[model samples]
Target: MLVAAAVCPCPPLLVPDVAAGAAPELDTARAACTDALGVLAASLPDRLLVVGPAGQSGRGPHPEGTRGSFRGFGVDLDVRLGTGNAGPAATERELPPSLAVASWLLERTGWCQAPVEGLGVGEPLAAERCIAVGREIGGRPERVALLVMGDAGACRTLKAPGYLDERAAGFDADIARALGSADVAALKALDAELAYELKVSGRAPWQVLAGAAENADLAGTLLYEDAPYGVGYVVAAWS
Candidate 1:
């Protein structure tokens, strides 16, 4: 069953190496993510599942030691899902970028309390399907903790990735509230069509979280919220 969860943004810039000279811009958000992960560790879950957006449907079950790299982002850094075990061989597929960011976060925090795993939910997955996958994850007999990573709208400002959009602020505001209050219904009701138009990649994974927390009585805390590069990035914790 779900015992705890941490919501984070999956921007490659979260990695200092990837961000390079601009790394300082995200220091606060990075710190908040660290604190959020600490909360998950405090819950003492039997397992930790890192959920994030991926390129295609049914993209992962990235087991422990699965590898990820940031070479494409102009950094030659590599990360593994967990500390021990020899991961996938050269012939095996590597994790998607979202999962790679997740792996980086785990490594930054030195995660060691539970066995870590990764699940990549397709960006365009329907709410029903995402929720179903989440329910299955929550149904596990052992306590499960989640680290969900994805970005909100990237059209908040004129300089944003998606450029200025009048509706971006409202959409991000609603998401912040739902996550801060642990409102499952609000998350389930998120409009996928609108999200797609706004470039909100977090929709599917957040809905998955809504499903997992459906039966749990969780209290939430909004740790961070910002549009540093005009892309909405939020960090929250539920326990």
Candidate 2:
């Protein structure tokens, strides 16, 4: 597939981490994530990749809730960094465009992020510098830009309904493919009022949900409800 940008959904990419729910900034970040997910879902690509800054919660260096890899987003992927082998949870840091591409700065900067060694979020890079770094990384296919500037330390709790809704958007097509349905009714089978099965029996990964996702059988099974957000995003595609 060709590289593309869904357009910038949020501005001032780098923001301080604040408390969740009550923190306005974090809320905005969630909203941005939600918006981005919507567009990506609407596009209905065969594969989806989500890259974000993981937090190391003193459990060996990777984020607690994130999976190092997953098969659901369509194919193979390894886009996680944090505690518990996920990498260290570092503070947010902003640097100038000039410093982001500097090997010296990247080596010296305190912006610690997984995928990158010895960098912390506290040390941010200039936009131009970051772009340069991206350039240095070398281009390939599908450059989906998703800023990991959200509540640095704030906790995000997704309600059952919200999670189901997100799953519908993120995996709607996948659901359709699995069910062999031509309509969007498969994902609509999820019910907000049902109990959440955050875990599946005999699963190695604790966070992996087994039966949580609703069945894709489109035979008049429509337990899921439309999102309360009621907001549709622009599905602009670019090369």
Candidate 3:
């Protein structure tokens, strides 16, 4: 059953090496992520599953020890899913960008309280399917915790990745409220078309979270919320 969860944005920029001089801008977000991981550790879950958005090449399950790197982003840093054992085959499948970011966070926090694994959900995955996947995760026999990584809208400003959109602010506000309160219905009800247009990669993953927490009865706290690069990045913890 679901025991705890931490939601975070998955931008590679969260890594100091990737952000370089601009890394200070995300210090608070990084701190919040650290605090959220502490909550997950306190839950004492038997396992930790990191879920994130991915494209075709990166989709599917990634066992513990699956490798990820920031080389593509001009950094030499690499991370593994967990310190647990994973056969050589595990390293053959690379993690998606979002999961790589999660791996970075786990390494940064020195997470060793639980065995870890990863799943990469597609951005275009239907909400129903996403929920189904989440239900399967939440229904696992072992106590499970999740580190969900994905970004909200990317069109907050004219210079944003998706460029400015009139509806971006309202969309991000609703997402913030839902995540802050752990409102499953709201998350499940998110409009996919609108989200797609707004370049919201978190929609599918957040819905999956909604499905997972359906019976967990968790209370939530919004740890951070911002659009530093005009991309909506939010951090929330549920326990």
Candidate 4:
């Protein structure tokens, strides 16, 4: 059953090398992520699962020790999901970009509290399916913890990735409130089509989290929320 969870934004920019000189821009977010991880560590779960958004080619399960690279982001850096002998499947399938960012955060924190694994949720995955997958995970007998990664609306400003949209701020605001309070119903009720239109990458994965915590009765804390480079990034912890 779910024991704890940490939610964070999954931008490659979270990596100092990837962000270069602008790394300082995200120092607060990074610190918040670190604190969120601390909560998971405190839970002493038997298993840790990292969940993130992915494209068609990146969807599905990634085992512990699975490899991920930031080379695609031009950093030439690599990371592993966690410490362990990677199985044949792990060796063959590389982690998606969001998962790679999670891997980077795990490495930064030196996580060793539990066996780790990853699941890449398709950005366009239906909320029902996402919730179902999460239900299965929460139903597992082992004490489980999750590190969920994805970004909110990308259109907060005129220079944002999706450009300024009048609706972006409201969407992100609702998301922040839901994550901050661990309001599973609100997360599960998120409008998928609206999220797609807003280019919100966190929608599907957040729904998965909502599903997982359905029976966990976790309490949440919002650690950070901001729109740097016009991308909505939020950090939260549930215990």
The prediction achieving the highest lDDT against the true structure is: 4
How high is the CA lDDT of each candidate model?
Answer: 0.91, 0.24, 0.94, 0.95
**How well is each residue in 11-82 modelled by candidate 1, as lDDT tens digits?**
999999999999999999999999999999999999999999999632867888878899989899999887
The TM-scores of all predictions, comma-separated, are 0.97, 0.25, 0.98, 0.99
Among all candidates shown, the one with the greatest TM-score: 4
Task: State each candidate's clash count.
Answer: 0, 39, 0, 0
lDDT of 2 by residue, 1-239 (tens): 21221221111211122122434633443344345334434444433222122223212222222332222223242332222243233222222111121111112232133222221221222223333333432232432222222111011124422333333343323322322222223323322122123211111100111111112111211112222232111111112
Model 4 C-alpha lDDT per residue in residues 126-216, reported as the tens digit of each score: 9999999999999999999999998999999999999999999999999999999999999999999999999999999999999899999
Q: Kindly report which residue stretches of model 3 are placed more than 4 angstroms away from their true locations once superposed.
A: none
lDDT by residue (33-89, candidate 3, tens digit) is: 999999999999999999999999888899998999999999999888999777886
Error of 3 at 169 (Å): 0.7
- Report the backbone clash tally of model 2: 39
| Model 1 lowest lDDT segment of ten | 84-93
Q: Give candidate 1 misplaced runs (Cα > 4 Å).
A: 87-91
- Candidate 4 residue runs with Cα over 4 Å from true position: none
Model 2 lDDT vs. the true structure? 0.24
Better of 2 and 3 by lDDT: 3
